[model samples]
Target chain A: MVGAGHAGLAMSRCLAVRGIDHVVLERGEVANSWRTERWDSLRLLTPNWQSRLPGFGYEGDDPDGFRDMTQTVAFLQRYAEVISAPVETRTTVTSIRRDDEDYLVTTDRGEWRARSVVLASGACNLANVPKVADALPDGIASVHSFDYRNPDQLPAGGVLVVGASATGTQLGYEIHKSGRPVTLAVGEHIRVPRTYRGRDLMWWMDNAGVHDERWDEMDDINRARRVPSFQLTGTDDGSTLDLNAVTDIGVALVGRFAGLVDGKAQFSGSLLNQCALSDLKMNRLLNSFDEWAAEVGADADVEPSHRLDSTRVPEKPPLTLKLAEAGIGTVLWCTGYRPDLSWLEVDVLDRKGRICHEGGVTSSPGLYLMGMQFLRRRKSALIDGAADDADDLSEHLAAYLDG
Target chain B: MSEATVNNGVNADALVAAREALTEAPQAAQFNWRASCEWKNGTHSHSTVEGFFGLGEEQKRSKTFAFDADHPEIFASEDLGATPVEYVLVGLASCLTAGVAAIAQYRDIQLKSVKATIEGDMDIQGILGIDDEVRNGFDGIKVTYEIDADAGRDDIEALVAQSQKRSAVYDIVTNPTAVTVEVK
Candidate 1:
């Protein structure tokens, strides 16, 4: 197995339970990304109780609270110890290729040959910055969410955040709180409340079985996998974090970032439509939850169901922003991430660099991918979702070996 | 469910079959529409459309189609026909209207009448070369649809939204496209 993150560690536990031997290769220590990639104030989007592995689950006192970066790293470290996973730390795999009937993994430390390979490296390895970023003026400091640590790292000026998913909304709120004006570029996003009807949204989704929606059951699995993360944040108070929250705190919301045109940043004029679409979808989801609650006779147990206010859109949003005139110095790209699988010398990748897979099974007979968004279920990318996927994939791998 | 093969004057079964066929043979779905225009006078021109390429071969219309385009007298040209920008509005309206009909038929909704009003706002300063900051095209375009259909208000609104979502001309007008121009 490649990587030593939650996915890899969970797969290791599964393999062990199945009496199969495997070594998890990690470039750094266990949970290397949680130790390095996340910002100082970042926390797990899901609640602590949702942090479950194959055989291990969160045993902390604050199950309702979120795990900050430090806590998350410690939790993973404890899981690694408890599972006794054969993790080879500080060994980065340079390439993986088919060697006749076996697979060979070459790393900086050494090499290993196995009959089957599980790619659990993760999905958010590289920030997907657009090509128009190169057109920006050299004086502006551009930072992807991957490399961003805090607001102090940015120069003293207004900032333009180029995506309004979870990362963008969180960082925009943080930087705005740090006394730097922020302009958030909004696009297609999923607006979900952190809590609903006196319970956490995760609790509602868990009870309603939204997370367990199978990939094959979806009408368009590709579209389902490409849906943006919810505009949410994990906070101690469990406060809802959405566009309205950020706007109430004085963050200027603009349309989608079109391009840098003639020294000025161009924005789309579809802000109203985008907000309407998001509002419509949010209401639809809440309605489904309400119907479920009524049908299951759980409405009397929870608070009265209510819908969130529609996103407030400006009557006439500005379509262009002169960076110099607006004193905007930094462009923070929270535009999402893509899996970095350049080292995989396999022929299973599609034209868009996505692995050709049905659920966790790859086109290649003995290869499997883990930890992708909606790999087998809707929650496949979440911390708690690894166990089920690992079990299914490990079963497939074992069966392939047996056959 | 209705057993009829046609709904709202559209052969829904044939449409679905064509969609499935194109999905199987995507190369045949690559259609190229063509039109030829000749300058008639200052700011006035005539265009003809009789042939296109589709289904992996050249195709011809049953009859030759023609159109005349000219600027208004206020723009210092003959008011012979609709302006080019007006033609663009027509394209958007027709495309969206067709999409609404097709989708409504698919959803088993009977339509009585459909009317669309399109307006594009433009600042002439850019086209006149009076201001470099202004843009030559419309700053914004708004389309309003009034449909008398056997559906609720929400259902009608959803139909219009879905039409805009699937309309080819709507996508063309809202997004950027690459075009090349050179002397032969």
Candidate 2:
């Protein structure tokens, strides 16, 4: 066990059940990512009912409700206690190397010689701030979504939130609602309704067998994996926050945050296209739902609303808030995240710096990965996906150890 | 930044006098206003509505405003100024904007700009008498605000909430009122 997050703890349980001895190393407390990397008002995109561990599922009062970061953290803490995972907290892994057949995992505390190693911390370790961030002037305070807590932490004045992913949209809406003039830079993303036909869309997706989709079956697995997360929000009522809703809340919509040229933020003029793309995708999904509902005899007759017209704003947003004006005091970067594999001395990284692996089994024998997006199934990277992923990885590891 | 200055687009002097009058003589605050319009052809109407500046005995002849309105093409009329439903939206937006400006001034925050987008969804089935199931009024209304001011998001949200709570039009729309019609 390498991480103490959902992936690590779940893997530990699988190993323990198989009577295999292993110690989980965590850089911080259990579910450290959930504790540190989430915003104040953050809620799981997946409903509480889907927040299931290997042996423990959600047994809370609000199973249909989405769990906020605080509730999620507490759930993980309880899960850790229930599983009794052998975890070493505050031990950061300094290096991991393959010594002949055995793996040498070194941490700040000490080193361990094991027959197999599982990199279970998963992706989303490093904030994927673009190079354009460097061009932004020092006068403006910039913080990635990972470090952002709330609007109160931001400086007064206008805000330019880069990236229209779930995090960006939510933050932009929150900040705009807080009364600051906000300009949200739109980008490519999967658009899905928060709810359809009185049921959470996740519930329907799960039932429709979307998460069980295997990579081999996908026409373009790489492209599918690269598709950004949905423009969905997790709230008590499960209200859908599309680009229209965001714009309706008074946040200025703009194209991709191309870069800061000559000390001004540059934006592309493809906002209308982005909105059209989102609208098309959302309608396709809804039409699919309609077909599914008919086939299943489900009482659902929700007509799709008009596509949110992006051409409404003609005036190209000030190409750049001249840094000299000092009007925009903060530039929030919510441009997603990537994995941090610097500690691994093993030659498993590909050209893109991504770990070279197939279905949790790396090219290097005795090395495996868990909690990776599209490792085997679409759900392979989610909390619910950990059980099966750990089971498969542990089975392979057990066989290798026996061999 | 004088306390008595009309910095927020609200006449501070007039507001102060009204507040004092309302406090001293509560009955003086009770004034009935009306909006009457004669229907032209189709859904067009020419309205010369009464303005709100006048109240009590000191008031001279009521100041009147004129505006022409027509239904949209879908509703079988030329797209004139704004439809009746649109006027409701306009009234709501203006009233809320006023409240925001007043709150901003009261808080001494500099308001640079404020714009509102008010939209109401309606099913034509009700108005067209195609179906009895549908209601006559808008099914739902959404009011979105874009405001630039030297204040925090929370401050602005609070200001908008305050405006909504204090707005008479908002109350009228939200709460049902009693109306009796009789032939004289």
Candidate 3:
């Protein structure tokens, strides 16, 4: 097994419970990405209750509580201790290949053979800071979502968070709270409920079969890409939590990051155009709930005090207050990152820099991928759901190990 | 330096020769399809990229079609995982060859097959950064074309030198392109 995050730990624990002996290989310290890349204030969207491995669930004062980056890093470290999972840290896997009966895994430290391998390393490997952005006037401070930890790290200036996806929106909210002037460069987004009003939306999605394999295989790449925005609360127990309310307070909303020209940062587009997209998605979700409620003979009249209207929003640049006069100082590239598979020399990856895979299996057999974001469910990327993902990949590993 | 040869620029014959050759053209071929477009979203969304080009379009746009989307543990999302830019890049690569093939049929130039590969680099940092000053779109795009034709290199170049498959995406990628954005 390669990697030691929630996916790797869950797989190892499942094996221990199943009485399967397997080896797990990690390139950095356990949960290294979570330990390193995550911003200091970062908190899991899923509560602590959901942060479980197969044989064990979190046992702490706050079952529903959410754990911040430190807590998560500590939790995974403790998990490794508890299960006595055979893990080697600071050992980067340099090459991977397959023989008839066994798979060969290589790292800077050593080469080892396993009957099967689990690529439990999550997708954080690729931190795609744009090449061109690096060439910008070095006077301005900039950072990717990965390197950003707290407000202290940013330059003392107004910030622009580009891309209105979760990262953009969430980070924009965080920085704004720091009392820094902030603007959110907006784009298309699908805003599902944190919960249907109050109840955990994942519960409905799970019970309604949102986690099924088929949901991952939906024909509408458009729809599948629209990962549901789940409840960021902890379970009934309140130890775990997400501070959505904290984020809403300080965010400055704007339109697409059209360009930066002259002394001013330029952003102009239809917020209504985008909100229309989000509004349609919201309606689709509500409609789905309504249809389900009707089928179950349940009422569907519940609605938020605030209703969304595509037309109500302004079309001009969405800056809370226009900064058209002054030169925009810094750009917080919350735009997102791309995978760096350069070290993994494999032809399986297409020209687009991706490996071809079906479910968890890569085009090359014996080489399996796990904990991929949106790999199987939208939840694959979420720590709360990575346990199930580990098990899903473990089954395949067992086949490889057993056979 | 040599008197005439070193001092002289290209002869008028060379310029005229190039233009005449471009105009010679292959036989004409026509393709007809009643297609209409509905722009419901930005860059490339809501719309499904189908038909053919490059390697080929997947019947479904599962996260699996693009390497970056599936390996989220590794790659971050650009358009919130909508893979539109991926669709656009693949479309240009595939359509250009298809453009050549249709022209081949129209011109009665026997063409065996056509395939192409394309890649584009974008400055996502500009989009994410405060200095909206950085270029947000692709910095440069390169396409390598491989064709098996009844005619040789000269024929394929003649066909591709003037093909309609060079659509908006291709034009923007090849030429100077900018989006005007101000306070208004």
Candidate 4:
């Protein structure tokens, strides 16, 4: 397996349980991404209680709380020890190609031959910035969410955050709170309250089986996989962090970042419609939870269901902004991430560079993928979700080897 | 289940098959639409559309379609026909409305009626060379849909949202596109 992150480690536990001999290769330390890529204030979106893997779960006192990056790294490190995973840290795989009946993994440290290989390196290895980024003027400093650590690392001026997913909203909120004027470029995003009806929103999703929705059951699996992360934040009080939340705190809200034209940052005029869409979808999700609660007779136990206020949209959102003139020294692209599979020498990638896979099984025989959005289930990328996917993929890998 | 399979005047199965086929043969999906325009008078032009290239071959419509574009009288020009911007609004509305119908049919939601109203706000300062800061195009565009369908309010809203998500002209207007103009 490639990578020693949660996905790789979880799969290792599953393989060990199944009596399969395998080694996990890590480019850095275990949970390397959590140790480096995450922002300073970043925390796991899922609550602590849900942090679980195969035969391993979070035993901390703050079950209802979210784990910060440090806590998350420590948790995963403990998991690696508890599972006694055969993890080779600081070993980076340079290439993986088919070598006759077996596969050859050429790493910087050395090389190894295996009957099968699992790619759990991760989905967010590289930031997927748009081509329009090249049009920005020379004055502004551009930073992707992966390299962004804190507001202090940015120049002292206004910040224009592009995108409204979980990363964008959180960074926008945090940067705005740090005494910097922020303008958030909104787009189509999933909105969910942090807490609903006296319980965490994730609790509702878990109980309602929203996260367990399998890929095959979806009407459009491609769309489901491309769906953006929910506009949410992990806070001590579990308070919501949506567009309205940031707007309430004096952060200017704009439309989607359309392009940079004539040195001016052009924004889309679909702000109201995008907000309306997100509001509608959020209410629809809440309504489903309410119906589920009523059907299961669980409504009497929890607080009464209520709807969140609609996303507040400005009557006249700014269509363009002159970055330098507006004192906007930084343009943070919190758009999204893509898997970095440049080293894979196999011809299994699709036109979009994504591995063609059904669940975790790739089109190339005996090659598997893990930790991708909606890989097998809706929660396939969540911290608590790795075990279930690992369990299923490990079985498939074993079968492929036997066959 | 049987009633759900009822066709709502749309060949959704054929569309799905075409989409799958085009996914495997993306070259066939490379379509080039064409329109020719002739200057009639001051700010008035005649445009014709009849043929387009798609499915890896040149294709023609059953009949030629023509349109007249002119500035309104407020711009000190002839009010011979609708303005060019108005045609853009028409394109966006028609494309989105068609998407709504197609998606509704595919989802098995019988539609009773669908109406769309589109408006674009343009600042003429840029076109008049009065202000370089102002853009030559619409400052913003708004589209509203009123529909009576078999589905609920949320489902209808989803139809409009999905329509916008897939509309070609909506993307063209919302995002920047490259255009080249030259004289032979």
Candidate number achieving the greatest lDDT relative to the actual structure? 4
Candidate 4, superposed: residue stretches over 4 Å from native: B1-8, B71-78, B121-136
Write candidate 3's Cα lDDT for B1-184 as tens digits.
Answer: 2223321122435544544554344121122222223344333223333332221222333332222221122344234343546656876776666666555654456655567788877777777685576666655456677877666554566566434223444444433347665652
Candidate 1: residue pairs that collide: none
Model 4, A286-347: lDDT tens per residue?
Answer: 99999999999999878998989989999998888989999999999999999899999998
Q: How well does each candidate superpose onto the true structure, as a TM-score?
A: 0.92, 0.66, 0.63, 0.96
Give a tens-digit lDDT track for model 3, residues A234-346: 32432211223323464456665554444345454334345555555565565666666667754544443233333234323433223333334567886666555565654
> What order do candidates take by lDDT, descending?
4, 1, 2, 3
> Best to worst by TM-score, what's the order?
4, 1, 2, 3
True contacts kept of 1: 0.00
CA deviation > 4 Å runs, candidate 1: B1-33, B50-60, B73-78, B102-113, B123-135, B148-155, B176-180
Please report, as a residue range, the 10-residue window in candidate 3 chain A with the lowest summed lDDT.
Answer: A238-247
Q: Residue by residue across A129-235, what tens digits does model 1's lDDT show?
A: 99988888878888999999999999999999999989999999999999999999998888999989988989988889899999999966877998898988888
What lDDT is reached at residue A23 by model 1? 94
Which runs of model 2 end up more than 4 angstroms from their true locations?
A299-326, B1-184
Clashes of each: 0, 3, 24, 0
Once superposed on the true structure, which residue ranges of model 3 sit more than 4 Å away at CA?
Answer: A17-19, A99-101, A213-217, A220-251, A261-264, A268-270, A293-312, A318-327, B1-184
Residues B82-174, model 1: lDDT tens digits = 999999999999999998998899877888899999999999998999999899999888989999988887668768876776778976776
- Model 3 interface DockQ: 0.02
